[model samples]
Target: MPRLFQVIGRQEPVATVSMTVYLHATSADYAAVGDDYLLVDSRGARGGRGFYDQHATIWSRDGRLLVTTQQVVWYRVTK
Candidate 1:
């Protein structure tokens, strides 16, 4: 599970546009800070795990992540 993030939603078409992301619900407690693989349909719905070792989705000319993924990693804490 990923613990730290700012899920912004991809709202524009640019080299790197600001994204608008909503918070994952209170399901798991750790989100790995790596690329989380994602899958989207023609309707613009994303489907995939929320955390991973590394994720980098390529973007298409239509402003959709070429693939569904972003970098994320498991949260590590020390006391």
Candidate 2:
């Protein structure tokens, strides 16, 4: 089984952006009975002039990696 996620809220304008994501588990990982799991997100930003990059990773309670993601955004400057 596959899960779907939706985000609903106010919309904001953004410049050019790129992103990559890796999901490292199947439904079985989530459907297991009597199993407790943990999720963690790590993020960072670098650069100036409204340009930055960020990354995040999700791990289980036992330090098993579940998912990883990265994204970059930058604005165009006009002279």
Q: What Cα-based lDDT does every candidate model obtain? A: 0.33, 0.59
TM-score of each: 0.19, 0.56
Best by TM-score: 2
State the weakest 10-residue window (summed lDDT) of model 1. Answer: 9-18
Q: Show model 1 residue runs off by greater than 4 Å.
A: 1-58, 70-72
Can you write out model 2's per-residue Cα lDDT over 17-72, one digit (the tens) per residue? 78898988776764542267677675555755656676888777767677798877
Off by over 4 Å in 2: 1-16, 33-37, 75-79
Clashes of 2: 0
Name the TM-score of candidate 1: 0.19
Clashing pairs in 2: none
